[model samples]
Target chain A: MKTYTRPLDLKNGRVDMSHGSGGRAMAQLIDELFARHFTNPILAEQGDGACFALPVGAGKMVMATDSHVVSPLFFAGGDIGCLSVHGTINDVAMMGAKPLYLSAAFILEEGFPLADLLRIVQSMAQAAREAGVPIVTGDTKVVEAGKGDGVFITTTGIGVVAEGIDLKPSNIKVGDKILVSGMLGDHGVAIMSQRENLTFETTIQSDTAALNGLVATMLDAVPNIHALRDPTRGGLAAVLNEFAQASGHGMLIHEKAIPVRSQVAAACELLGLDPLYVANEGKLVAYCAAEDAETLLAAMRAHPLGRDAAIIGEVIADTNAFVQMETVFGGRRMVDWINGEQLPRIC
Target chain B: MKTYTRPLDLKNGRVDMSHGSGGRAMAQLIDELFARHFTNPILAEQGDGACFALPVGAGKMVMATDSHVVSPLFFAGGDIGCLSVHGTINDVAMMGAKPLYLSAAFILEEGFPLADLLRIVQSMAQAAREAGVPIVTGDTKVVEAGKGDGVFITTTGIGVVAEGIDLKPSNIKVGDKILVSGMLGDHGVAIMSQRENLTFETTIQSDTAALNGLVATMLDAVPNIHALRDPTRGGLAAVLNEFAQASGHGMLIHEKAIPVRSQVAAACELLGLDPLYVANEGKLVAYCAAEDAETLLAAMRAHPLGRDAAIIGEVIADTNAFVQMETVFGGRRMVDWINGEQLPRIC
Candidate 1:
C-alpha cells in the first residue's frame, strides 16, 4: 500500500477539468478516491461495467433511477451523498424487493472543492455499506465551473422481487388501511431551514434513512402489503393523492394521527409550509389489509427507524378519487395535489 | 388521450423551477412531453419506479451507467439525449449482453428553453426505439439557472448476458489480435469542428450509434471472442493499454492499418492531436485469438457499423505491458496513456 507523500489538497484544492478527461489524472482519482472507498470484488474488476454472479433461484427483478440535485450539498442530518444512496434503495424496496446492486453517476463542476467531494463520497460509501448495497458501477463527468452545481448524483438501483409479493399503487384496495412509518416534513423542513438561514437552538435534522430493513420486517410480519411509498419530493399529500388516483379510490386521512416532530412543525409554521405537503425522506406510507394494519404497525414501531409509527388513514370508495383529511378540530379539508411544490431541490 | 388547451409554450416558454417542483406543473410537463413521447405500458403505470416482467430463463445480468455532459446540447450528428442512450447501451453491449431496459435521469437548468427540452426528449425516445431498448423509468430535476448547463443526462442500462459468453479485459491473451470496428476520431472531430466553428465541406458527423446489433453479429459469427470495448472517451490508446495491462502483456499496433477519415485526419492535424487518442462513439475494439481474426473481421465487415473495420494491432508477451505502434514510415514509438484526456465530455 503506497500513500502519496503529497496527497490531493482536499482542504484548499479544487476540481479541474482534466480530472475528468479520462486520462491518468482521472484514473488516479478513481483509484485513490472512488475505488478506495467503494472497494469490492466486483467493483475492483474495473471492466467497462462491473459483473458478478447472482443468487440461484431468484425471482423477478425491478430497477429504478433517481437524480438528486439537492441544492445545499450538506444539510442538517444527511448530505446529498447518503440521500442519493438511500433514495434509490428505498425506491427499489418500495416494491417489496431486496436491492442487490447500485450504479452511481456523478456530474461535478470545475472549481468545486475537492474536500466537499471527498466528504460526499465517503458518506455515499458509508450509506451503501450500511444498506448492504454496494455501488457496483459508476461514471463521473465534470462540466465548466459556471455550468453546474457543486455536484449532482444520479443513482440507479436493481433488486429482485419474489413471485406473488408485488407492490404497486394500483394494487391498493378501497378497504385498505394506511400507515406512516414516522414523522412528516422533517426532511423538507431541515433543508428549508438551512437555505433560509434560520438558526434553531435544536436543529431539525432531515429524516433520511434507508427503508429496506424496515420494509423487510413489515413484510415478514404482515405478509400482505398492497403498496409502499416514500413521501419524498411532494411528501405525504402527494403520495396519498397518487394512491387514490391510481387505485380508483378516495383517501380519508386523520391529521391528528400523522406524526410530526415539534421542531419541524414550528419551522413549517415559520415558513408558512404545510407539514402535510412537505417532504420526508426516512418516512414511508403503506397500504395493507385492514386486519393487517395493527400487525404491520407493531412491526414498524419495533424497528428503530419507526418508533413513532401510526395508522394515518384508510382507503375509501369514491368516483372522483379525492383525498380528504379530518382536521384536529373536527373540520374537513381537501388534501389536493398542490399546483407546484413548495420546496425545490429538497430531494 | 388529452391535450392541454394552452399547452406549454414550447416555442417561446422557458423551463422554470416549477417544472421540477414535483407538483402539478411538473406533472403536466411529464405528461405532455416525456410521457407522451416515451409512451409504454410500464411508463404509463407511473409509480415511483416502473416494474415489468422479464423473460424467463434469461442469463446473468449486467448493468452500466454513463453521464453525458457534452456542451452544446445539440452537436453536429447527435444531441446529448441520443448520445446518453447509445453510450450506456454500448457499455452494456461491450459485455456481449442483449440490452433489455434503460433508465434516464435528466438535470435541466431553470430557464432552459422548453422547445429544446422537447426536441431532446423526442430524440432520446427515437434512439431508444431504434435500438430496440425501451427507457423503462426516468427522473427529472431542474437546478437553478446558473447552477447547471442547459441540460445533462445520465442513463443506466441493464442487460442479460447469456452464459458461456464472458468478455473482460483480463480474458485477453498473448497472440490475440486487436481490431477496430471503424474509423477513429469522427465523433471527437465532429464535435470539435462545430465548437471551433469550422464548417467542413462534407460535414463530419458524430459516429454515435448503438452497437448491440453489430456486437450480436460478431458473437454469433465467433462465439469465442475474448474481449470487447467501445473506443470512447480516452480513445483506442486507452482501450489498448487497458487490455494489455489487464492481460499482463504488450501490444504492437500498425499505424498504417488504423482507419481515419480524411476530414477527421485534417481536423486532428489542424489541432495537433493524435488520431489514435481521439474518441469514436460508434466504434469498438475487439481482442480475440489471432487464428479467428479473419472470420471476426469478415463478420464485422458485413455489419453496417463496421465497414471500415481492420486489424490494427496484436498482443505479445511483455511484463512491462507497453503499447508500441509501428508507424507507416516503418518506425516504432511507444503509445502511452496520456496524462489527461485530450477531450472532455466527448461522449
Candidate 2:
C-alpha cells in the first residue's frame, strides 16, 4: 500500500483544490480521513465501486437519494453529516424497507476549513454506526472558492422491502386513520432559531434521526399498514396533501390531536409560521385501517424515536381531495400545501 | 392529480429558492420538468423512493457514485449532464456488472437559467436512454445565488455482476498485459481548451461516454479478465499506480504504443501537461493473462468505442511498485502519480 510521508494537518489545514484533484492529496485525504472514519470491509477494499451480495430472502430493492444543501451546516441537534444519513434512511424506511447501505458524494468549496469537515464526517460516521448502515462508496469534488457553499453532501440509500409489505400513497383508502410518530416542526424550528439567532428559554434541537428501527416495530405490529411517509420538507400538511391527492380522498384532522412541543409551537408562533407546514426530520405519518390504528400507535410509542406518537386524523370521502383541519374551537379550515418558500435550505 | 395552472417557462425562467422549498413551485417544477423528461414507469409512480425487484439471475450488487462539477456546463462534444451519467455508469461497469438503475441529485444555484437546466436534463435523459439505464429517483436543492455555481450533479448507479466474473485490482498478475480501450487525454485537452479560450485548427471534443456495452463485449470474449478500470480523474498514470500498489507489482509501458490524438498531444504540449496525467471519461484499462490478451484485444477492437484499442503495457514483479514508461526514443523514465491539481472540476 502507498503511504504518506506525514499525516494530514487536520487541525490547521484547509481544503485546497488539490484535495479534489484525484492525485496524491486526494488519495491521502481518502486514506487518512474518509477511510479511517468510515471503516468497513467493503470501503476498505477501495475499489472503484463497492460490491456485495444481497442477503438471502431479501425482497425488492428500494433506492432513495437526497441532496443536503442545508444552510448553517450545524444546527441545534445535528450537522449536515448526520442529517444527510438520517434524511435518506427515513426516505427508504418510509417504503417499508430495511436500509442496507448508503453512498455519499460531496461537492466542497475551495478553502473550507478542514476542522469543520472533520467534525461533519465524524458526525456522519457516528450516525451511520448507530443506524447500522455503512457508507460503502463515495466520491468528492471541489469547486472554485466562490462557486460553492462550504459543502453539499448528496447521499443515496439502498434497502429491501420484505414480500407482501406494500406502503404507497395509492394504497390509502377512505376511513383509514392517519398517525404521526412524534412531535412536528422541531427540526424546522431548530433550524429557524439558529438562523435567526433567537434565544429562547428552552432550546429546540433538530429531530434528525434514522427511523428504520421505529418503522420496523410498527410493521411488526401492523403488517397491513397502507401508507408511510416522513413529514420532511413541507411537513405534515404536505404529506397529508400528497396522500389526499394520490388516493382521491380528503384528509380530516383535529388540530388538538396533533403533537407539538410547546417550545416549537412558541417558536413557530413568534416567527409567524404554522407548525403544520414546518418540516420534521425524524417524524413519520402513517395510514392504517381504523381498527389497526391503536395497535400501530402503541408500537410506534414503544420505540425510543417515537415516544410521542398519536393518531391525529382519518381519510374521508370527498370529491375535492382537500386536507382540512378541525380547529380547537370547533371551526374548520383547509390545511393547504405551502405556496412559496418559507425557509430556504432548511434540510 | 394536482395540476399546475401554467407550465414552467423553460425559455425565460431562472431557478429561484422556491423551486427547492418543497412547496407548490417545487412541485410544479418536478411535475412539468423532471417528471416529463425522465419519464419511466418507476419514476412515474412519484414516490419518495423507487422500488424494483432484482433480476433472478443477477449476481452480487455493485454501487458507484460520481459528482460532476465541470467548469463549463457545455463543451464541444458533451456537457456535464451526459458526463454525470456516463461517469457513474462507467464506474459500475468497471466492476463487471450490468448497470440497472440510476439515482440523481442536483444542486442548482438560485438564478441559474431554467433553459440551461432543461438542456442538462434533456441531455441526461438522452444519455440514460442510450445506455439502457433509467433514472428511477432524483432530488433537487437550490442554493442561494452565489452560494453555488450554476449546477452540480451527483449520480449514483446500481448494477449486478454475473456469477464467475470478478474484476478487482488485486486480481492482476505480475505477467499480465495491460490494454487501453481507446485514445487518452482528449477530455482533459478539450476542457483545457475551453478554459484557456484557445481555438485550435481542429477542435478537441470530450470523449465522455458510457462504456458498459464495450465492457460487456470484452467480458464475453475473456471471462477470466484479471482487472478492469475506467481511467477517469487522475487519468492513465493514476490508474497504473493504483493497480501497481494494489497488486504489489510494477507497471512498464512503451510510450510509442499508447494512443493519443495529434490535436490532443498539441494541446497538452501547449498547456505543459503530460498526456499520461490527463483525464479521459470514456476510456478504460484492462489487465489480462498473457494467453488471453489477443482474444480480449480482438473483442475490444470490434466494438465502436474501442476501435483504437492497443496493448500499451504489462505488469512486472517489483517490490517497490513503480510505474515507468519507455520513451519512443528508447529511454525509460518513471510515470509518477500526480501530486497537485492539474485541472479542477474536470468532470
Candidate 3:
C-alpha cells in the first residue's frame, strides 16, 4: 500500500479538469486520502450509495439538513469538511436525539484543487468518526469554474430520539433555567482573523467541534430538559431571542455569568462586533426546570467541551419577550434580537 | 378577510425596513399575500413553526433537502419558493417514494420587499398543495442587507418508499430501456433569457414543477423501474453519465427519440449551449427492462406533464461507462458529461 504522506501545495496549485474525471487520478485521490481518513465499513463499500441497516429501536427518528457555504473553504482551526459534519449533527442533536448517520452532497468547482478537496474530505471523515456518525451516502457534482466557489457541501443527518422525551419550546416554562455550554464568540473571531485587510493577531481557533457527545451527557443527566439550541450563524443573542419568543416568555441574564474568552472579547472589541452576536460552533444553550439547573450544570461541566459552562439566565413571564442582561456594573441592558448579519458567512 | 386584487409593482418598488419590523405592515403583507395564497391548516396556525403529525407507514422513509439561491428572485414562470419545494420533492420522488411533508428555512435579506417575499412563500405553498405535500414546519431569519441576496429558501422533504420497489442505479442492466418524460432545456433557457445583455425575444416559460404525481403514475404502471433520475442542473447528459458509471455499463441514446421543443433548441443554438446539458426541472429519465418500455411510455403519455414522453435509448455493454448519442444526421456522437456551467443562477 502507498503511504500517500505527501503534504499538499496549497498556495500555488489550482484545481484542474482531471480531478473530477473518474479515472486513475480520482481513484488515487479517494484511496490515498478519503478512504484513509474515512475508514468506515459503509464508505469502504465504494458504491454509488452506501447501504446500512438502521439500529433496532422504538424511538422516533429526527432528521436535519444543512448547507455549508463559508468563504475561503479553508478557515482557521477548521475547514468546510468538518464544518459540514458539525453543522448537521448539531441540528439533529438539538432535538435531543442521538445522531446516527449522515449523507453529504458536494458541488465542486470544476478546477478545484484535488489536494485541497482530499484534505477537506479527510477532515470531514475524521469529524464524523469522532462524533460516532457514519457517512452513509453521498453525491458529487462538478460545476464549471466561476459557477461555484471552490467547494460547497450539503449534509443531511438522521438521529433517533427516545420515547417520552418530548423536547420542544412549548415545553419551556417561565421559571426554566438557561445555561451556556461554554465560551462565546471564538469561532467568529477565528474567521475574522482570516478576512482580507481585517487581520488581527490572536490564537483564537474556531470552536467547531462535534457537540453530540456533550449533548448526550447532558441529556442523560437531565432527560426532561425543556429545550436545547446550538448558537451557530447568528450566535447566542439570536438564539435567546428566538427561544424567548417561542416560549412566550421574557429572559433576564447576568452578563457576568456568560463565559467569553478574553481573546475573543478583545478581538470583538477591535472589530466593532458584539460578542453576544458573534457565532460559536461548539457551544449550546440548554433550558431546563429551575430545580434541575444545578444537576445539569454539573453534568455539563464534567464533559470535555463544557468545562466552562455556567447558568446564564432565567425565563420570566412576559408577552413582550424581552431579553435583558444585568451588566457587570450593576445595571441592566436589553439584549435585543440581532438587527442583521454580524459577519456574513460566519458558519 | 381583506382581498388583495391589485397587481404588485415589482419593478418600481424598493424594499424598506418596515418589511421586517414585525408590525402592522408585516401583518398586512402576510395576510394579504402569504396567508391568502398558502391557505393550509398548519400555516393558518401561524406559530413560529408549523406542527403536524406524520402519516402512518411501514415503508422505509427517504428525505432530501435543497436550498435555492437563484438570482433575479422572481423568474420567468416561477420564483425561489416554488423552485425550492419542487427541487426537494423531486429529489425524494427520484428515489421511487411518495413525498409527504416538507420543512422550509428562509434566510431573508433585510430590506427585501414584504410583498415579494410573500409572493414567493405563497407560490411555494401552492406548489406544495398541488403536489399533495404539506409544508409542515419552517424557520425564518432576516439577514442584513448586502449579507445575502434578496432571499434564500432551503426546503427539506420526507417521503416513504414502498417496499419491493428496489430502485437503484446498480440494478440498471445492459439491455434496460431509457425513457424521458418530456422536452428538455426549457427551465434553463427561460432563466438565461432573463439575464442582462443576453437578451432574447421568446416567451419561454420554465418547466419548474413537482414530479411526485408523475412518478406515482409511473410506479403504478411499472413498479420494477430499475432507476429514476431528474436531469436538473447539469441536465440529461450529467444524469446519464452518473447512471452509466454507477451501473458499470455503456448507454446509447437516439437523438431523434429524445424530446426537445423548437424554442429551447433555438435558444441553445443561439447561446452555444447543448440542450442535453441544459436543465429541465419538471422532466425525468427512467430506465427499466426493455420489454416493459412500451407500457411505461403509454402510462407516461397519459399524464399531462409527460405527454411528450419518448423511449430515448438503451443501455449497452461496456466497461468504459460511455453515454453516446445518435446524431440527427445519422452520425454517432458522445453525449459526454457537462464540463462547465452552462448558465449561472439557474435553479
- Highest lDDT against the true fold, candidate: 2
lDDT by residue for model 3 (A1-347), tens: 22223543444555554333333333444565556676777665454334444445536666666667676577788998999899888877888778877777665666687678878988998899889998765545444565456776777776777766667777889999999999999988888888776756689999998899998899889999998888876678877877776678889989889999999998999999888888888899999999999999999999999999999999999888888999999999998755434676565
- What's the DockQ for every one of the candidates? 0.67, 0.87, 0.13
| Per-residue alpha-carbon lDDT of candidate 2 for residues A271-303, written as tens digits (9 for 90 to 100) | 999999999999999999999999999998889
Residue A209 lDDT (model 2): 99
Better of 2 and 3 by DockQ: 2
Tens digits of per-residue lDDT, candidate 1, B236-316, equal 888887777778899999999999998888888888888888888899999899999999999999999999999998998
Where does model 1 exceed 4 Å of error?
A1-11, A196-202, B1-6, B196-202
Relative to the true structure, candidate 3 reaches a TM of: 0.82
lDDT of each: 0.87, 0.92, 0.76
RMSD of each: 1.9, 1.1, 5.6
Best by DockQ: 2
Estimate, for each residue in B230-305, the C-alpha lDDT of model 2 and write its tens digit. Answer: 8888899999999899999999999999999998988888778999989999999999999999999999999999
Candidate 1 chain B, run of 10 with poorest lDDT: B193-202
**Fnat per model, in the order given?**
0.76, 0.88, 0.00
User: Candidate 2 chain A, which ten residues in sequence have the lowest lDDT sum?
Assistant: A193-202
